[model samples]
Target: MEKRMIHLDETDLAILELLQEDARITNVALANQLKMAPSAMLERVRKLEEKGVVKGYSAAIDPLAVNRELLVFIFIKTKDSFANDKSARALAAIPQVMEVHHIAGDDCYLVKARLSGPMELMEMKRSKFSKIPNIISMRTTIVLETVKESSHISIEK
Candidate 1:
């Protein structure tokens, strides 16, 4: 199948900005804000999804409220030969992992993980992660505080 690029106009961009702020906003409310009919607004949103502009929606959970005790950024350098789908899949299966980014330069992958405490993080390193074959090295940095985190994407239209 061939993929087509759909260009978004200013109105579409505005709609996206509003939705990013609150994904659960009702279609009628969004239409009122954008000054368009609800049916038209819904069609635009459906088109955005079809074109893969709006991938999906998710709730932003407060980590503190859920007793999340730690946030760690792990840099992993794997053996060049071992960097493949097998290794990536192995890392993804670990429950503590929140995000995995394939990086350039010295490190092969960077992983963001949330855990209960230092002890749990250490146990994960020794038991689950270390068992993965051909892992060259793993470096971890615990987050002291989050300065800024925004899901909003800047759109120029």
Candidate 2:
């Protein structure tokens, strides 16, 4: 993917900040808060979406309610080169796997997975992950408690 610097004005920043706080905020309400016309606010939001500054919005689900109470971060060491996407693609294909990061040092990939319990995690490892090619080893870490977890990024005021 190509990386480029996106120039954002104060209005754009403000809009992003507001959206970050409440993704479900209405266009009229947002415009009212920002003291701008609703149409103008809509246009700005559209521009933000087009520029890829604003991604799609969705409701945040409670993992416990969904029976995905266990949050596990697995550090994966693969037989393939770090640049290879084979293992990453395979991991990404799994529905339980949330995020996959190609990292530095001994570990090739770090995967975030949600499971019902320890038994389900072990079963997933034995059935799903173990079937994937080029996996050398894996180290799993379970989260005891979530101190902070948010997808929002800081926007200039």
Candidate 3:
């Protein structure tokens, strides 16, 4: 099926801005803040969802608060043959993995992981990562500090 792109007006943009600030805001409260009727506000929200503007809501959790120690970015170079089901299965079994992106350019994939310390990272590399078939190489970088982290989409409309 052909995909259709939805254009957002100023009102839609405003609604998105408010929602990004607080996803849990009730429709009534949101309507009051936006100076629109609750029903109208609800309709706009439903339209946004239908158009895929508002993908989904999620609770932002503090990694440090939960004893998540190390944040590592791993650049992976996989053999061409590994792109099939085996590579995906190998990646899925790793519990420390937070996110994986299929990247362009030299690196085949970029993997984000949270672990306890260097020891855990090393163990993961030695055991699970090494065992993955047709992995050419893996480069890892530790994040000392995060300057900024945000999920808010900057709407240019």
Error of 1 at 134 (Å): 2.5
Q: What are the per-residue Cα lDDT tens digits for candidate 2 across 11-124?
A: 899999989889999999999999999999999999999989898898889998999999999999999875679989999999999999999989999999999999999999
Output the better candidate (1/2) by lDDT.
2
Question: What lDDT tens digits, residue by residue, belong to model 3 across residues 1-157?
Answer: 3788788888899899999999999999989998999999999999999888899999998887876779999998888553454665577679999877767888777888998889999999998898888678888999999999788888766
**Tens-place lDDT digits, model 1, residues 8-98:** 8999899899889899999999999989999999999998888899999999988878767699999998875633656667888999898
Off by over 4 Å in 3: 1-4, 81-93
Give the worst 10-residue stretch by lDDT in candidate 3. 80-89
lDDT value, candidate 1, whole model: 0.87
Predicted structure with the largest lDDT when compared to the true one: 2
Instruction: Point out where model 2 deviates above 4 Å.
Output: none
Q: What is the descending TM-score order?
A: 2, 1, 3
Question: Which predicted model would earn the best TM-score?
Answer: 2
- RMSD to the true structure for each prediction, in A, is 2.4, 1.1, 2.7
